[model samples]
Target chain A: MKRRLLLVSNSTLHGGGYLDHCQQHISSFFGKNVKRVLFVPYALHDRDGYTKTARDKFKSLGYDVDGIHEVADPVEAVRKAEGIFIGGGNTFRLLKSLYDNNVVTEIRKRVMEDGVPYMGSSAGTNVATISISTTNDMPIVFPPTFSAIGLIPFNINPHYLDSDPNSRHMGETREQRITQYHEEPNTPCVLGLREGSMLLVEGKKATLLGTTKARLFTSGKPSVEYDPGSDLSFLLTDPMRS
Target chain B: MKRRLLLVSNSTLHGGGYLDHCQQHISSFFGKNVKRVLFVPYALHDRDGYTKTARDKFKSLGYDVDGIHEVADPVEAVRKAEGIFIGGGNTFRLLKSLYDNNVVTEIRKRVMEDGVPYMGSSAGTNVATISISTTNDMPIVFPPTFSAIGLIPFNINPHYLDSDPNSRHMGETREQRITQYHEEPNTPCVLGLREGSMLLVEGKKATLLGTTKARLFTSGKPSVEYDPGSDLSFLLTDPMRS
Candidate 1:
């Protein structure tokens, strides 16, 4: 089976309704076959509220959204899910819950082996990568490890912001942070997905989607930019796996 | 022996030279008796370059500085040092080196038990606290643990920035990130130190230093603001310790 994934940088854009900016992409990705999406609201503290917002938005798009939290057995739910969607919030909390629920393996299998459609926004998108090391969220809690779902071979830095020459903040810029990640030996490439941008992957092909361009950082190489509709299938090639 | 510490929010403020804004506090914190300081430049990748910057600045303040990396044994370097200073870079990288060099326990003892004056800027200030959960830096690398030296009872969010109301970025503001941190049970209070602000600790008493106000966030309570010279001794009282 081939993998199908839509990884979004954010759930809501400034002045936009939840998932409003990416409605068209979300619709096209799921197509008419996926009737429902199993929502993982663990990233957020208010699971019920998160689910309601996701449920309402997906409903308008003609799909029922079932929160994995609402189910009795989460692992079984992942195994039986028609489609899987993880919402945005704190990345640390999201990864912790993913481990605590013991569905990491099941979800990986569902998406990798069974070809269930997977959708993730922000923290959700972060977990779909090899590791959450590139996430911008605070490490409020400790998970057993930083290793994530690995649905994709590389890491995704959602809401990637470029340095403002006018700003005087002393903290590391998004690019600098990703550069630091590349310092680690054998680390994978990192994609900096700006707001309103996302990656659409099907089988062995991956493409940049949405309005903005994405920055790609690979070890020992100059960072490059990819515009909308550019082929990003090279990102799916995991040297370790290949 | 009294515990002495100077935790700074940043090494260089906007339009200011390195440590130029906080020279008086650093001078007073070290006093005339401490003529030399041991520097930890592990947070940054370029140890020599970071050390040179720190060395020049401390020299201008009338102190001889030696990089810990220059010494044969980092543990011994921490033991006989008149004052210990850890410069700012990446928090994860800093904490990892602290553990990797086998000096966390030694440095903690040098400050907590031996009363050797200790100073930290940015990333350095973060590790002096209970954990690095509230840091503003990216987790570029995985440390063995989120735990730090814990010279103080709570966590410090250095280079903390207030939300710009005019900005349209959908990412969570600094305050929201700390709020998410309090959602975890038994988490310690977090202090958000704005740029140019710092904390001065002597024995059981802690005082907010520098020009800016600091925000303190305790779990299940509203955050409170503290001006310069405000008594923050209560923060030193750890519920777990006492």
Candidate 2:
């Protein structure tokens, strides 16, 4: 139980401001003692700009946030951090940065072994899962691998949405795409984390934290929907209970 | 100008039948003389089932279509093919299969060198580009490479959509994603082909064939919208005229 993770579906809600709904959760999860937060800003095209935006937002929440890029050593930055926050823009870019910086192992060690509180949204949430396989982002760049930090057992389809049943477009719906993914036997379960939804994980317990219901897709099994505030900790277990 | 290719944005229109709008174009492009079409059904989970569906549809158009999977040697089939059709499902799967079967070279030879009439929709259209980097599909599985047949001079965003101007979704918009891609500077132009649109390429000349206005994104240049029936062959040229 040496892990603390607050994985949010998105940074902003529809018609809301930046990091609107996630601020309170982040503050509560980190508590007042955590001061210096190491921010992963690689998902965006402009690292400094993205970090500035995140920094300003976190500043308003009474926390000192530093971009991992601002530091000379990414691994050392994570080791010295009181908390970690990964801002989402592009999952491929973020995952590649983790590998390219050679800090994937360091961050894993810091979070899993050191129990540094971790928070992520959108692409951040995608990387906190078992793999980056379920992300909805374009494959703009090839990553070294699809592997990600296994902060949680299941994969996350952040900013998840249902297909517009009435649209004439032929693109596969989010549901269809994930369904095809489960076509391969033994694939892990996927959580369709809709906008405004999130998963709060502390040690062995995890909870769905939002108004929207999360859709769980399991191979060879009917997809189930869990309401907000529902116990989703079992999802953190291997071969999740039905 | 030995290559002839028909790239469609999608297989079916919303609330419409499968491949309905595309049958005429397919028939006209292939004509009655071209029999024995080699179909690539590797994108779908059920290759045989997808082949059967396509066969029925193409048969009604007076064409003899055979799935590449049915042949003993896929390369041999492509070599003898009068034309080629790649059905849509998943781009990652299709590209992986193309590499796994060692048919990527064969198909490129047949299409780029031998001048075989080629048709692809959705995931199929995705591989017709320089790379699969612009595809909107999930990264369900890793392909050996993001490299595709390079049938076209530039990349494609198949099933392209304009971001909803009225709403708030934290996920990057189709435009934002492609624009971010262009930020890399050396990235090639991206043609966003909306549903119901098709691009017709014969040798070095290419034409947009549907009603949708294809948005072309080039770095350091404003995106231009090309109306249906416009000559896009200029897009085939290197260092496109501003």
Chain B only, TM-score of each candidate? 0.97, 0.96
How does model 2 score by TM-score? 0.97
lDDT (Cα, tens digit) per residue for candidate 2, span B1-242: 69999999989977677889778899899987897788899998998889889999998988888889998999898899999999788898889889989998888888888899999998889898888988998888889889898898688888899887775566788999898777765788899998889999988889999768899888878999999999888878862344
TM-score of each: 0.97, 0.97
Per-model RMSD to reference? 1.9, 1.4
Poorest lDDT segment (10 consecutive residues) of candidate 1 chain A: A233-242
CAPRI band of model 1? Answer: medium
How would you encode candidate 2's per-residue C-alpha lDDT over A54-160 as one tens digit per residue?
99999999998899999899888888999999989889989988999988888788888889999999999899888999998888888988889888877999998
Best prediction by lDDT = 1
Give each candidate's interface RMSD in Å.
1.0, 1.2
